[model samples]
Target: IKDHLKHHQTQTTCWDHPRMAELYQSLADLNNVRFSAYRTAMKLRRLQKALCLDLLSMQAACELFEQQALKQNEQLLDVPQLLSCLSGLYQRLEQSHAHLVNVPLCVDMCLNWLLNVYDTGRSGKIRTLSFKTGIVSLCKAHLEDKYRFLFRQVASATGFCDQRRLGLLLHDSIQIPRQLGEVASFGGSNIEPSVRSCFQFANNKPELDAAMFLDWMRLEPQSMVWLPVLHRVAAAETAKHQAKCNICKECPIIGFRYRSLKHFNYDICQSCFFSGRVAKGHKMQYPMVEYCTPTTSGEDVRDFAKVLKNKFRTKRYFAKHPRMGYLPVQTILEGDNMET
Candidate 1:
């Protein structure tokens, strides 16, 4: 059964499978049954198998179990006890995002996010459903899949989320950029504006359904922009372009390939670009287009045209015409404030 499931793993996660629903329902039904350690462990093990969880997830679960066992001073087997084990998950999160400059801050923000989303009562305890939903939302899946999963977690039985639920999602999402130190680039850490913008985009509906939620996500609201960027960065990590870095002189530039719009055939490797290294003649302010994937022939032609046009322009013209890499969304509230 495991091997058969593994064959289709690429196409679908266990969460989306019917068997998962059955397993989840069975686990829930266990709550009504009398407490039995053997029964509870067997149910949990089945659910874990269905999740196809990685070593880290399994290890985290084990740690949580140990913590609960030590603290409870009893061997009562319950679903809540199994899921409430977040003792060492923070350290695991830190290790996963080791590239982050302030991993501790990121982990702290994530912990707060968990508490906010799952433990609304501030009781430090969360339901098994909440625990599974939270972990699945943060799993290394497609970005859209994660978005859909998160929305469903907060959505009503009819698959709709009111303003408050949407706000919760946005608030939790903004913490990613906040911890990465990229929140300022999109907008401040305020989530209210983003919620307003989303509702406005959804035609001011009383409750936003999945389709509306997806549409808003497609716009990539300021507060949640960092997630898409993170996905792009991850996708580009192993991407190799057939261009040479003019500064580093590395052939077949690996990772992000940055092409200068001002200079013909000028390219910079990801390392050089991040370090702010420029060749002798190129200025730091000169506009450059970033490519996570390799450029096509048509793109090469278009870039050539852009470079030709830029070459004729004066330095002052280039300075005055600065290019932004991302689309900036101005909410109605912000615009109204600007007028006031």
Candidate 2:
């Protein structure tokens, strides 16, 4: 009894406490054998939450000390199971702490715990699960314009999106991909431009995080992974934008900025093969390839590699000759059609 009663706050957890013994005792008196499964599941959920509270406490302490090294005497826990418990607690928070939640603490603590777990150098099995768990919770938190950080980390780990912070399509959507929920992969035409929303939901990182809505516009060449979804997002935008340009009303592009002119005329439509500017030498228009190429960046080729499926949503269209920034391997068929 003393072993159970004598407690350490860090050792004391919600799992052992939330399902108050009193509740079980009361349920025992009901003797409803037919309802045992429901009762048991509810009881289990409560236990998981309790465990999460303690795990979070420990995680907080670990983070507080910047303890990258696992403690010599940390509890002997099933790392994966413990991580799962933490995730369950977070998922349930939407049901309970959805209102009074400490937004920043939740974000910082979870990310710290996750970054530590990932660097633990163990068999990366738990790392994978822990990351997915932390990410889902992270998606729930306010982005606070933190997509770049998450984007960079994920890009390094998964090779999905560029880490350059390119200020383009990503700024619009807010969503992230879950490894278990969606098998993030190259599209190879598996997805189309019409249903980009479904692709974003399944693969788009920027869509997974709403930082774009908060105004973090940038133009650095980062890797954009999650290409299949990006194509859909781009296709959707292109379809909608095709009508925005006045000179090329039927062009395939959604919206475009000027690439530069052979002599500065705005009448040329790249997609339609309307070479040369209007009669009075207008700035070439429609296919604005130069501005889209992002020549200012000095990134390596891999720097532009799309690591995950989500980054494709904001893939850039830059010139192929001495390309300005790193570009996604898909789509982006090269610039120069305007001259042809």
Best by lDDT: 1
Tens-digit lDDT track of model 1 for 136-254: 53445676776776787678889999998887666655554343234564566777778888888889989999888887786555566545555556567679999999998999999
Best by TM-score: 1
C-alpha RMSD by candidate, in order = 16.5, 19.5
Off by over 4 Å in 1: 1-123, 126-134, 177-188, 312-320, 326-340
Model 1: how far residue 52 lies from native, Å: 12
Model 2 segments more than 4 A misplaced: 1-124, 128-144, 148-239, 242-340
Instruction: Pick out the ten consecutive residues of candidate 2 with the lowest summed lDDT.
Output: 172-181
lDDT of each: 0.57, 0.30
